[model samples]
Target: MKITVQLFARARDLAGAEHVELDVPAPGRVADLKRSLASRFPQVSPLVPSLLVAVGTDYANDQTQLSPDVAVACFPPVSGG
Candidate 1:
Protein backbone atom coordinates (compact mmCIF):
# COMPACT_ATOMS: atom_id res chain seq x y z
CA MET A 1 0.00 0.00 0.00
CA LYS A 2 1.10 3.53 -0.75
CA ILE A 3 1.02 5.97 2.12
CA THR A 4 1.65 9.69 1.95
CA VAL A 5 3.64 10.88 4.95
CA GLN A 6 3.82 14.48 6.00
CA LEU A 7 7.21 15.94 6.84
CA PHE A 8 8.03 18.89 9.06
CA ALA A 9 10.95 20.83 10.51
CA ARG A 10 14.32 19.12 9.92
CA ALA A 11 12.71 16.18 8.18
CA ARG A 12 11.11 18.51 5.67
CA ASP A 13 14.42 20.26 5.14
CA LEU A 14 16.23 16.98 4.67
CA ALA A 15 13.62 15.48 2.37
CA GLY A 16 13.29 18.84 0.58
CA ALA A 17 9.56 18.41 0.50
CA GLU A 18 6.47 18.75 2.68
CA HIS A 19 5.44 15.18 1.98
CA VAL A 20 6.65 11.85 0.59
CA GLU A 21 4.98 8.70 -0.65
CA LEU A 22 6.16 5.36 0.68
CA ASP A 23 5.32 1.75 -0.03
CA VAL A 24 4.01 0.51 3.30
CA PRO A 25 2.68 -2.83 4.39
CA ALA A 26 -1.02 -3.01 5.01
CA PRO A 27 -1.86 -3.46 8.73
CA GLY A 28 1.66 -2.28 9.35
CA ARG A 29 3.53 -1.10 12.41
CA VAL A 30 5.43 2.13 12.90
CA ALA A 31 8.65 0.14 12.76
CA ASP A 32 7.85 -1.05 9.26
CA LEU A 33 6.97 2.47 8.24
CA LYS A 34 10.30 3.75 9.49
CA ARG A 35 12.21 1.18 7.51
CA SER A 36 10.32 1.97 4.35
CA LEU A 37 10.86 5.68 4.84
CA ALA A 38 14.55 5.15 5.28
CA SER A 39 14.94 2.91 2.26
CA ARG A 40 12.82 5.10 0.04
CA PHE A 41 14.06 8.47 1.28
CA PRO A 42 17.60 8.13 2.44
CA GLN A 43 17.78 11.88 2.73
CA VAL A 44 15.63 11.52 5.85
CA SER A 45 17.17 8.25 6.96
CA PRO A 46 19.23 9.73 9.76
CA LEU A 47 16.16 10.99 11.47
CA VAL A 48 14.43 7.64 11.31
CA PRO A 49 15.88 6.46 14.59
CA SER A 50 14.67 9.42 16.53
CA LEU A 51 11.76 10.28 14.31
CA LEU A 52 8.54 11.34 15.96
CA VAL A 53 5.74 9.50 14.20
CA ALA A 54 2.17 10.59 14.50
CA VAL A 55 -0.73 8.46 13.42
CA GLY A 56 -3.36 11.13 13.20
CA THR A 57 -2.73 13.64 16.03
CA ASP A 58 -1.22 11.25 18.54
CA TYR A 59 2.40 10.29 18.80
CA ALA A 60 3.03 6.67 17.79
CA ASN A 61 5.62 4.24 19.00
CA ASP A 62 7.36 1.58 16.91
CA GLN A 63 4.79 -1.07 17.72
CA THR A 64 1.78 1.05 16.96
CA GLN A 65 -0.45 -0.72 14.49
CA LEU A 66 -1.42 1.19 11.39
CA SER A 67 -4.61 0.83 9.42
CA PRO A 68 -4.93 1.34 5.70
CA ASP A 69 -6.62 4.72 5.88
CA VAL A 70 -4.85 6.59 8.62
CA ALA A 71 -3.11 9.93 8.41
CA VAL A 72 0.59 9.70 9.10
CA ALA A 73 3.33 12.25 9.62
CA CYS A 74 6.91 12.22 10.80
CA PHE A 75 9.32 14.82 12.12
CA PRO A 76 12.46 15.19 14.14
CA PRO A 77 12.19 15.97 17.83
CA VAL A 78 11.82 19.68 18.59
CA SER A 79 14.05 21.44 21.06
CA GLY A 80 14.01 25.22 21.24
CA GLY A 81 15.25 27.49 23.92
Candidate 2:
Protein backbone atom coordinates (compact mmCIF):
# COMPACT_ATOMS: atom_id res chain seq x y z
CA MET A 1 0.00 0.00 0.00
CA LYS A 2 1.10 3.53 -0.74
CA ILE A 3 0.58 6.23 1.86
CA THR A 4 1.16 9.94 1.51
CA VAL A 5 2.63 11.58 4.60
CA GLN A 6 2.60 15.31 5.25
CA LEU A 7 5.60 16.89 6.90
CA PHE A 8 5.70 20.09 8.92
CA ALA A 9 8.18 22.31 10.69
CA ARG A 10 11.36 20.49 11.68
CA ALA A 11 10.16 17.30 10.10
CA ARG A 12 9.89 19.00 6.73
CA ASP A 13 13.34 20.42 7.21
CA LEU A 14 14.81 17.09 8.23
CA ALA A 15 13.18 15.29 5.36
CA GLY A 16 13.99 18.10 2.97
CA ALA A 17 10.49 17.61 1.70
CA GLU A 18 7.02 18.82 2.54
CA HIS A 19 5.48 15.49 1.64
CA VAL A 20 6.62 11.92 1.00
CA GLU A 21 5.06 8.86 -0.45
CA LEU A 22 5.82 5.56 1.26
CA ASP A 23 5.24 2.03 0.18
CA VAL A 24 4.25 -0.17 3.07
CA PRO A 25 2.82 -3.58 3.56
CA ALA A 26 -0.91 -4.06 3.41
CA PRO A 27 -2.80 -3.24 6.60
CA GLY A 28 0.24 -1.35 7.84
CA ARG A 29 0.07 0.32 11.23
CA VAL A 30 1.28 3.77 12.20
CA ALA A 31 4.26 2.17 13.92
CA ASP A 32 5.11 0.38 10.72
CA LEU A 33 4.90 3.60 8.82
CA LYS A 34 7.16 5.24 11.37
CA ARG A 35 9.75 2.55 10.90
CA SER A 36 9.59 2.91 7.16
CA LEU A 37 9.90 6.66 7.38
CA ALA A 38 12.86 6.39 9.68
CA SER A 39 14.49 3.90 7.34
CA ARG A 40 13.97 6.04 4.29
CA PHE A 41 14.85 9.32 5.95
CA PRO A 42 17.53 8.77 8.51
CA GLN A 43 17.76 12.48 9.13
CA VAL A 44 14.23 12.41 10.51
CA SER A 45 14.79 9.32 12.68
CA PRO A 46 15.72 11.20 15.82
CA LEU A 47 12.69 13.41 15.49
CA VAL A 48 10.32 10.53 14.78
CA PRO A 49 10.03 9.67 18.43
CA SER A 50 8.78 13.16 19.19
CA LEU A 51 6.57 13.46 16.17
CA LEU A 52 2.79 13.23 16.34
CA VAL A 53 0.84 11.47 13.66
CA ALA A 54 -2.67 12.29 12.54
CA VAL A 55 -4.94 10.20 10.42
CA GLY A 56 -7.44 12.44 8.76
CA THR A 57 -8.68 14.85 11.45
CA ASP A 58 -7.91 12.67 14.46
CA TYR A 59 -4.62 12.00 16.15
CA ALA A 60 -3.36 8.45 15.85
CA ASN A 61 -1.27 6.14 17.98
CA ASP A 62 1.42 3.71 16.86
CA GLN A 63 -1.12 0.93 16.59
CA THR A 64 -3.49 2.91 14.43
CA GLN A 65 -3.94 1.27 11.05
CA LEU A 66 -3.09 3.17 7.91
CA SER A 67 -5.40 3.52 4.94
CA PRO A 68 -4.27 4.36 1.45
CA ASP A 69 -7.36 6.49 0.95
CA VAL A 70 -6.41 8.78 3.82
CA ALA A 71 -3.44 11.07 4.17
CA VAL A 72 -1.30 11.19 7.31
CA ALA A 73 0.12 14.32 8.79
CA CYS A 74 3.30 14.28 10.86
CA PHE A 75 3.78 17.09 13.34
CA PRO A 76 6.85 17.84 15.37
CA PRO A 77 6.35 18.82 18.98
CA VAL A 78 5.61 22.51 19.39
CA SER A 79 7.62 24.67 21.73
CA GLY A 80 6.66 28.23 22.59
CA GLY A 81 9.09 30.74 23.89
Candidate 3:
Protein backbone atom coordinates (compact mmCIF):
# COMPACT_ATOMS: atom_id res chain seq x y z
CA MET A 1 0.00 0.00 0.00
CA LYS A 2 1.24 3.45 -0.88
CA ILE A 3 0.09 6.14 1.51
CA THR A 4 0.81 9.85 1.73
CA VAL A 5 1.82 11.03 5.19
CA GLN A 6 1.54 14.60 6.41
CA LEU A 7 4.22 15.59 8.87
CA PHE A 8 3.60 18.25 11.50
CA ALA A 9 5.83 20.37 13.71
CA ARG A 10 8.75 18.30 14.92
CA ALA A 11 7.94 15.48 12.57
CA ARG A 12 8.16 17.84 9.60
CA ASP A 13 11.47 19.14 10.84
CA LEU A 14 12.85 15.66 11.35
CA ALA A 15 11.70 14.53 7.95
CA GLY A 16 12.80 17.73 6.27
CA ALA A 17 9.54 17.80 4.33
CA GLU A 18 5.91 18.60 4.93
CA HIS A 19 4.75 15.38 3.35
CA VAL A 20 6.19 12.02 2.47
CA GLU A 21 4.96 9.14 0.36
CA LEU A 22 5.58 5.67 1.69
CA ASP A 23 5.24 2.32 -0.02
CA VAL A 24 4.07 -0.31 2.42
CA PRO A 25 2.76 -3.83 1.99
CA ALA A 26 -0.70 -4.36 0.53
CA PRO A 27 -2.15 -5.00 3.96
CA GLY A 28 -0.46 -2.41 6.10
CA ARG A 29 -1.02 -1.35 9.69
CA VAL A 30 -0.04 1.65 11.77
CA ALA A 31 2.69 -0.45 13.32
CA ASP A 32 4.07 -1.08 9.87
CA LEU A 33 4.05 2.60 9.11
CA LYS A 34 5.87 3.33 12.33
CA ARG A 35 8.61 0.85 11.57
CA SER A 36 8.93 2.01 7.99
CA LEU A 37 9.20 5.62 8.99
CA ALA A 38 11.90 4.83 11.48
CA SER A 39 13.93 2.89 8.94
CA ARG A 40 13.48 5.32 6.09
CA PHE A 41 13.87 8.47 8.11
CA PRO A 42 16.26 7.69 10.92
CA GLN A 43 15.90 11.18 12.29
CA VAL A 44 12.25 10.39 12.99
CA SER A 45 12.94 7.12 14.80
CA PRO A 46 12.99 8.57 18.27
CA LEU A 47 9.82 10.50 17.74
CA VAL A 48 7.80 7.61 16.33
CA PRO A 49 6.69 6.37 19.74
CA SER A 50 5.29 9.76 20.62
CA LEU A 51 3.74 10.60 17.29
CA LEU A 52 0.04 11.12 17.05
CA VAL A 53 -1.26 9.33 13.99
CA ALA A 54 -4.43 10.33 12.28
CA VAL A 55 -6.02 8.41 9.50
CA GLY A 56 -7.93 11.11 7.73
CA THR A 57 -9.62 13.31 10.33
CA ASP A 58 -9.86 10.69 13.06
CA TYR A 59 -7.13 9.63 15.38
CA ALA A 60 -5.80 6.12 14.86
CA ASN A 61 -4.04 3.66 17.10
CA ASP A 62 -0.99 1.55 16.47
CA GLN A 63 -2.98 -1.38 15.17
CA THR A 64 -5.08 0.68 12.82
CA GLN A 65 -5.31 -0.72 9.32
CA LEU A 66 -4.15 1.31 6.35
CA SER A 67 -4.95 1.44 2.65
CA PRO A 68 -3.15 2.73 -0.38
CA ASP A 69 -5.45 5.67 -0.90
CA VAL A 70 -5.63 6.75 2.72
CA ALA A 71 -3.67 9.73 3.94
CA VAL A 72 -2.00 9.68 7.35
CA ALA A 73 -0.91 12.57 9.48
CA CYS A 74 1.85 12.38 12.06
CA PHE A 75 2.15 14.94 14.81
CA PRO A 76 4.64 15.08 17.59
CA PRO A 77 3.37 15.24 21.14
CA VAL A 78 2.32 18.76 21.96
CA SER A 79 2.95 20.62 25.18
CA GLY A 80 1.58 23.97 26.27
CA GLY A 81 2.48 26.08 29.23
Against the true structure, whose lDDT is highest?
2
lDDT against the true structure, per candidate, is 0.89, 0.91, 0.89
Q: After superposition, how far is residue 60 of candidate 3 from its true place, in Å?
A: 0.2
Q: How high is each candidate's TM-score?
A: 0.90, 0.93, 0.92
**Residue 18 of model 1: what lDDT?**
92
Counting clashing residue pairs in each candidate, in order, gives 0, 0, 1
Model 3, poorest ten-residue lDDT window? 19-28
Model 2 alpha-carbon miss at residue 14, Å = 0.7
Residues 1-81 of candidate 2 have per-residue lDDT tens digits of: 999999999999989999999887889999999998999999999998988999988999999988899879998887879
Candidate order by TM-score, highest to lowest? 2, 3, 1
RMSD of 2: 1.3
Give per-residue CA lDDT, model 3, range 1-81, as digits (tens).
778899999899989999998877769999899888888899999998888899999999988999987879988987868
Query: Model 3 residue 58 lDDT?
Result: 94
In angstroms, give how far residue 36 of model 1 lies from its true place: 0.6
Model 2 weakest lDDT span, ten residues long:
71-80
Candidate 1 lDDT over 1-81, as tens digits, reads 888899999899988889888888887889999999899889889889899999999999999988768899998998889
